[model samples]
Target: MKLKSVFINTTNCITPLGLDVETNIRNISKGISGIRLHKNLVYAEQPFYASIIENSLIEEAFSSVSSSEEYTRLEKMMILALMPVIKKMNPVFDEKTILIVSTTKGNITQLSTISETSAQSADLSLMAQKIASFFGFITEPVIVSNACVSGILSLAVAKRLIQSEACNQAFVVAGDEFSKFVLSGFNCFQAVSNEPCQPYSVNRKGVTLGEAAAAACVSANGQNALAEIVGDGAINDANHISGPSRTGEGLFRSVERAMKEAEIKSEQIDYINAHGTATSFNDEMEAIAFNRSRLGNVPLNSLKGYYGHTLGASGLLETVIGIESLNSGKLYPSIGFDEMGLSQALNIITQNEEKELNYLLKTASGFGGCNTAVLFKKAK
Candidate 1:
């Protein structure tokens, strides 16, 4: 049986850079860095660089569509990011449509302050249900919380659902908010970068966290679609809990499988939106993986410098910007890169350059040794 093609029809994002896709793309095109220093916010008495949505802004946006007093910050951001696309689709909540929520640390901020109902408020499933119910989704919501891969992996799941006739359309939303829980965990690992992130740079320190919510509508309908999801793969090398494989084993296999499923050779790939977290191990591992897959010559970049590491939202946020890149026929530079930092060479994008991007590859690696690769093509 021939599987139906899944296309990304529309997308939107709410981040420090902007509240919509076009705005975020314009800011990134001008080399604007959203990651900035915030004093005593997530980490008290310690200044850290992060990309965060201001509380006032969130309240202001939420007030337009809702007067509810019970929504949490994460829920508000998710609603704001998804509201425009939802309005555009105005999709009926029926058996044919499904909602999927992807997040790493939903309502983790509840842990920062002691509350009698703290554990209940921090429930990921409850958060997913609230978002789904807010939109009147008839079907029970699905949740994807697999580390950083949650964002992109949700897309792959949506594609499969359509192909399998489980649903005719899907709205996938992925988000994470900056909180003491996340910051403190990273601090414990010494993975929090002091300066703005610089992926694939010799002087790169570590990752800078960020907060964002990104959503996309996926369907079998091809009309006016932004891009087609051609292929996808997920793998876990199980190298380590917190560290990536020394040899890029899992990433290499994931990219290889995705390319094979797309029925495209490495040379056909026009651009790569890599998961360069600016960590020393991650950059080096990705470089080795690209070289292993013979994708070393493809021009690639990491948007972390502009968005910081938005955790669960990074994959979808980066992919949305990538769609813009392909439509504009221009490659955005990896914002904070200065020089080649890995032993294996990658043709990193240094400056904005005009290129006809037909096939784009997006790769992401996370804790628990999970890595995902997804291939997308221009809808034409």
Candidate 2:
């Protein structure tokens, strides 16, 4: 039996730079970064750089959607990110439709209080259900929580579910919010950058955390699709609890599998949206993996400088922008890069350029040695 084709039909995102996709793209094209230094002791003991959405902006935008005061800030962001897509497509919430929520920490701030209501709010399943119900989705919602890869991995999951005849249409929403818990955890690992992150740069210190929510519609129907989901692969090296494989073994294998499934060579790839978190090990590991996959020469860029590693939202947010890149034939620069810092060389995009792009590759690696690669072809 032949498998069905899956395509991303519509996309939207809520970020510190903008609320809509076009606005975000405009800011990015102008080299505007959302990362800012914050001295709030609630989030960190010392001043730290991060991309954070303004509370007033979120409240104002969400007021037009719903007047309920019960929704958490993260939920509002998720709803805002998904609202535009749902309005544009006006998809029917039927039995054949599924909702997928991806996140690393859902309302983890609720835990700071340690109350019954807070505990329920922190539950990932409950959060997913609430989002689903808010949209009037009849089917039970699905949760994807695989470290930092949750966003992109959710898309892969949607593809498989549609292909397997389990669901004809899928609504995927991914998000993570800034909280003291997350900041302290990364602080413990000494992975929080003091300034805006510089991926693959000699001066790079570490990652800059951000909060965002992104949504995409995946369906078997190819009508008005942004891009065709051709292939995807995910692998886990289990090298360490926090560190990625030193040899890029899992990432290399993941890319190999994706290319094989797509039946394409690395030379055919027009550009790569890499998971360049600016961490020493992650940047080095990705450089190695791309070179091993013969993708070293492909023009690549990391959106971390612009968005500051939005945790679960990074992959999907980057993927949304990448889809725009394919549609517009424009490449955005890797914002904070100065000089090559990795042992393996990569063709990092430094300035905005227009080119006829056909195939785009998006990759993400995260804790627990998890790595994912998904291939997309420009929709004709």
- Local lDDT at 26 for model 2: 97
Q: 308 in model 2: Cα distance from truth in Å? A: 0.5
Cα-based lDDT for every prediction:
0.92, 0.94
lDDT of 1 by residue, 225-259 (tens): 99999999999977898899989999999998889
> For candidate 1, which ten residues in a row score worst on lDDT?
37-46
Please, what are the lDDT tens digits per residue for candidate 2 over residues 1-380? 87888999999999998999999999999999999999998887789999999999999999999999878999999999999998888988999999999999988999999889878779998888889999999999999999999999999999999999999999999999988898898889999888799999988999999999999999988988999999999999778879999889999998898899889999999999999999999999999999999999999999999999888989999999999999999999999999999998999999999999999999999998899999999988
lDDT for position 10 in model 2: 95
- Residue 102 in candidate 2, Cα distance off native in Å: 0.5
Backbone clashes (count) for model 1: 0
lDDT of 2 at 112: 95
